[model samples]
Target: MSIRRAAIWSFASQYASFVIQFATSVIISRYYLLPADVGLFSIALAAAMVVAIFQDMGISRFVTGQPEMREEHLRDYAAVAVGLGWGIAALVAAGAVPLARFYGEAGLAKVMLIIAGSYALFPFSIVPSAMLTRALDFRRLFQANAGSALAGAVVAIATAANGAGPAALAWGMVAATLARLILVMAAYPVLPRRPASLEIVKPMLGFGGSSFVISLSGAVGMRCQDLIVGRMLGVSATGLFTRASALAGQLTTLMVGAINSVFYPAFAKKRDAGEDLAAPYLHLIACNTGITWAAAIGLALAAEPVVHLLYGPNWADVAPLLRWTALAELFFVAMPLQMDVPILLGRIKPLVWINLLDTFITVVILVVASFWGLEAAAIGRILTGAIWLAIYASYIPRLVGIRYSALGTAYLKSAAVALAAGAPLALSRWMSGAGAEMGFISLLGLSLAGVFCWLVALPLVRHPFWQELRLALSHMAKLRTTQA
Candidate 1:
């Protein structure tokens, strides 16, 4: 299947997921749970997931990265996943009480124990999902993910209403994982019966080992924030931070997550075809930075009213943290395929170091910043982001065989487009004072103005993003015309 078709299916899946997860979260946050309630769950969930990284152990990349995935190899991968997934679930179940005691929250133990249930289903889902991805069969992914999202949402809302507190969120995850396992199994009904041979597992150890390290480090960086923040600033502060980041991250995820799922395999496919990866990589950066940067800025600018409108006055404090978190997303998207391109080029050794550095910087900076206060912890993200871009910029281009000058040129054009897109909103915010003063409706209007300016500026700036927009619009128009 074409990347375009796969992306469409992937986006449909993600779009449905975002809507379900977003709606459930809003309901829970506004009506059901307090920030401390969320924080309690967040800390436990973070710990469990950090260990749960072993469930995959790079199996998805290993599957997708393979040039010719024989049935025997699939069996091998599935065996490894089962052992690790089950082992990790046992570990999480065992540690729940200890971790909760360490955090001094009995509720943490309950949440972690509930979350442990999902990992039992993890191995069943992982290989099938990877197989679907390897085939670019995102249509199946859509079915599985959408069903999973709906199941999770319904469970979360129902449980929260029944006074399950934060455990409701954990139950929702368990439901989502089980639903995905069932759906993905139906979509691709095949699995290894038992463990693969020692020889089979030995060969995979090299790739899986590096991937495990990279994944472990990346997970630590991503999920450890809740742990670090909760320990230092207290659960309420962690709750506020988590709440702010959930919204900011959700918005960014809705934009980039679909592309992310598609791109690793897409890049591998291109590399196997002996295509020059540099151009596609640059084009990806162009498109990503153009859209994501603008949206992140808009979210930052509209954070106040967005918080007020979405979660009510209770979450008004999410505004400032949202602004910083949204801006931090720009750094992430600015360097597209930071992991995939390097892994594709057989540069996992350097990628591993980069990932370690990435995690180190993330933990150190956030820990120090948390000492000051919650918002300071967020501002610390901008510093970590800048450093992150610098860290990856040094090596990713070299792996992709792109010159720094060409990469810099792409950055400049994308930055220009982002600035053009953001200028209207920035000016409006400047004139209108805080987002609350402008109100949600006016803030939305300001955002529309930004979109209009973005459309108008694209062609004037002669950026490649203009052509991408035109192509997408033309494709949609053609589809409509055909239907008509």
Candidate 2:
């Protein structure tokens, strides 16, 4: 039930959920609908995300960051969050018609309404979820996520088989959310026990106010690409870009979420106790950066065949975009340390402003690049991520008093390792008839080549990562020896 064990379990669940979701997407996109339907579904999903942004002001984050939590506080915060969720969902639902009209898609109004209305239920689930996280009880989370993903996948596949198109997408998401809610509620012992009250509302909002702005700005910034693409190049292009970006986002989210779920609670507790917490913070940065580099490189090298096999020939166009966006994962993966750590340390104002700046710049870039089409828009996404990472890296060291030089060196080495692994795969594919066949054999061969190249080159770049690996092994060995 410790934070470390919680992180491990959450990571395991994420992996399982990811596999199920990825397999489901492939089956649905290839066997059921045209690329156009996929595009519209992406838009509807983006609208859902935007509406969900205004739901609860991250009160659950506030709760998790608390050093000490009580059942009364849980009930109070839950009531406030649920009240806010319903209020926001209702307002957005009311505006759905006008918003869809503005977008020239009256049909989307109904879809948006359905997606937005879910926000009403979402906040009610947050307190139980946060309580589990605060207790480092991610076994419940893992179970919930895995079960939800499997059940949702089955529902989606069935709907898609029945020719439901984008409605299938909506059904799948709703199913997943409902399943997650049910599982979490069943696993959690405490439930919200009170009605809405102002007394429970004040502290939650006070603590999470800056987090609210940051979360809102971040949502706007993150979805700026979809907004611009949907407006400029049409839904089809937006769909392709969004689908590719989603894959990369999943990987980034898994790493950042795993770390954040553990580090935030630990960091907040340490800060509350006035402890000097330098080592754990640095260790997290190193571990995340290293893991991110590995995933990005591996993905970048195998993007073409990976896309061909995973998404079918119709989605082949997304391969290049996926590669470009995957690089952003490297930068985004370190986000937990650079962003969440500041919040845990109570430096909320700066975090809010930083996110605001990021959103402003992102909106400008996204709008401008939309004129150039989807490829340019994809590049814009990468550029925005790189700029944000640079800004964070520059300021965070001074804010936290960590040696920036050490962090910088680690990042540089990680990037080098990534490039080394990726370059060979790119070259090998180019030399292998430019990956034109799109057959099973070709894809399998390319995958093997990529794996071989990655394995051969990985250990050559840095001994430090390998040393850490060995240290982990040694520690495991010692633990087993003690147990015996």
Candidate 3:
């Protein structure tokens, strides 16, 4: 499949999954679930996810990224992957009760055990999914992910309606994982059956060992945002923070995350071809920042109305948190693919330290800020992001063989694109005054106008995203004409 086709498949899958998940969230939050319920589950899920990082073992990247792999290599990798997957499942299961007890919530244990069930099924999906991604066969990927989301959403709503409480969310994860596993295995049933030898496993472990540190900071650190808030504030506070951060994350994920899944292998291919990665890297930065920044800025400006619309008034506190987190997203995407770029460039050792420092800075900020209030923690996020960008400033360009000047120019154009995109909504908010309530129809209309302005401004600013967007449109038009 072509990159564009693969990306389209990815977006279709992501949006479908997001819609299901989003609808489920709205339903549960509005009617069924309480803030404390989500907070309890959020803490439990975060722990499982952090422990689940061990399953990475660099297996997917190893499989997808390598330019060459012998049959023996594949078999050894598969064997190692299976062993790691099962090990992580066991680890999560073992830690479940202890973690729950530590949190003083018995429900956390139940939620975690169900989460453990999902990880047990993860081994079955990992290799197959990676193989499909490497082949750019996103059709099967779409089937797996979309099916998983639908299954999960059904289970969540059904269980929540029946009063499963926090465990409902846990069951949703198990159902989702099972659905994904079935589809992925159906697509690629044959796995290398041979056992991995000591020498063969050595490199995988070494790479994974290094990778674990980066994942530790990036994945766990992000999740710890909730954990910290839950411990310091309360379950309700955690729920609000999780909702806010999740919203910010979901926006970026919905917009850019799907295509990013394709880029790992894409970048690997370019690397193997001995291409200078700077231009593609900058194009990626330009494209992603243009989309993510605008969406985030719009989210920030319209946080109150959006929170009211999707989550209802009970989640009103989430609005202010969302505002800061959304702007923090600007700095987060300022240096796109921080870990991935470093991983691809073989700068693992240095990346580890950078990530550690990144974690330290973020945690300290949150801890100190939490004393004031939820709003303080949220504001601290923006500072963390600014520091994040500064730490990455000197490293990324050098790794990608790009100069600072070129990076600055790309960022400038993307900033212009974001400002133009958000102009209408920002203007509307300003005119209506800070205390004004924006009705759904008005908010919707302004958002659409902002989108139109964004598109128009992209070409005006001579953005790389504009060229790519125009080309994509042209391609679609031609395809339609040919079919007709």
Candidate 4:
């Protein structure tokens, strides 16, 4: 399948999953749970995510990016994945109490214990999912993900309705994992058998080891805010921050994350074929920034009504934090494949060092900022994100052979388009002087106007993004005609 087709399927799956998951969270937050309840679950999940980084041990990437994958290699990696999954489960189970005690939230221990069960089921799906991705068979992957998300949403909403508190969230995660495992296994039934030899393991470990370190450090940086907020401020503050971050992240995931899932494998395929990556890399950056910058900025502008509509009035405090989080996300979306480019090119060691530096900067800033309040910690995130982007800019040109001028041109054009898109909304807000008091109908109108303006401004910016957009639409039309 073409990259466009693969991305369409991936986006369709993610958007469906997001709708279900987002709705489930809204129901829980608005009617079923308190901020503190959400916070407790968030903290436990963050801790689990840190340990969960090792569950795959980068075996998925290894499978997807390996130039010459074989049946024997798949089985070998699957066996390693199973062992790692079980080990992660054991570690989480053993450490659950200590983690909860550290946060002074007894409920967190229960959430941790419940979520740990999902780790055991993870290995059952990892290799199959990776194989599907390697094949660019996003249709099957979509089925599995959408089915799992639906199942989890049902379980979570039902449990929350029955007053299960934060444990409901954990149980929902377990259900999702099990559902995905079953679905993917049915889609591609290739179970791991006994390894034929230990020789295959060495190369995988060499690649996966560095990948693991990068992932581990990255996870620590991402989740350290939850830990700090939960420990220093309280569960309420953590809950607010979690809600804001989730809202901001949901936009990026909807806009950029799906495309990125396809990009790594696509880049890997290109690299394997000895193709020039510079042009494609620059185009990818332009496309990513054009779409995500518009979305992120729009979200920031409409944070008030969006938060109120989705999360209810009790979550009003999350709006300002959401705006800041969206700013941070802008930097993130600017270079969606910064790390992946290096990894795909076999420059893993530098990527690891960069991630470590990112983690150090992130942790120090977050820790110091937490002393002031949650907002400060959030601003600290934006600071770290900007610094990390600068670091990526300095290295990416050398790695990919794309000049800084080309990258700057892409970013500037995208930023201009974003500013153009947001102008209508800004003018409307200023003229009305309604600010956060704007009703849903008015806010929705401004958002629609912003999108319309963005489409109009696309070609005017003279960015390659408009051509890519046209190509994507053309592909969609062709696909529909073929189906017809």
Q: Write the per-residue lDDT of candidate 1 for residues 300-333, one digit (tens) a residue.
A: 8788888888888878788999999999988988
In candidate 3, which residue ranges exceed 4 Å CA deviation? 72-75, 191-196, 434-436
Q: Better model by TM-score, 3 or 4?
A: 4
TM-scores for every candidate against the unseen true structure: 0.97, 0.91, 0.97, 0.97
lDDT of 1 at 289: 80
- What shift in Å separates residue 16 of candidate 2 from its native position after superposition? 1.1
Tell me the tens digit of each residue's lDDT in model 3 across 223-328. Answer: 8888899899999999899999989989989988887887878888889999888888888888889889989999999999899888887888899999999999
Off by over 4 Å in 1: none
lDDT of 4 by residue, 1-484 (tens): 8888898899999999999999899989999988899999999999998988999878888888889987756777788889889999999899899998887778888899998898888887999999999999999999999999999999988898998999999999999999999999998877777677778788888888899999999899888779888998899999999999998889889887888999889999999999999988888889889989998888888888788887788888888888889888889887778767898898999899988998899889888999998888878778987998988888887798988888899999999889988888778767876656778888888888998889988999888879977987898799899999
**Cα misplacement distance, residue 328 of candidate 2 (Å):** 2.8
RMSD of 3: 1.5
Q: Could you tell me the TM-score of candidate 1?
A: 0.97
What are the Cα lDDT values of the candidates? 0.86, 0.74, 0.86, 0.88
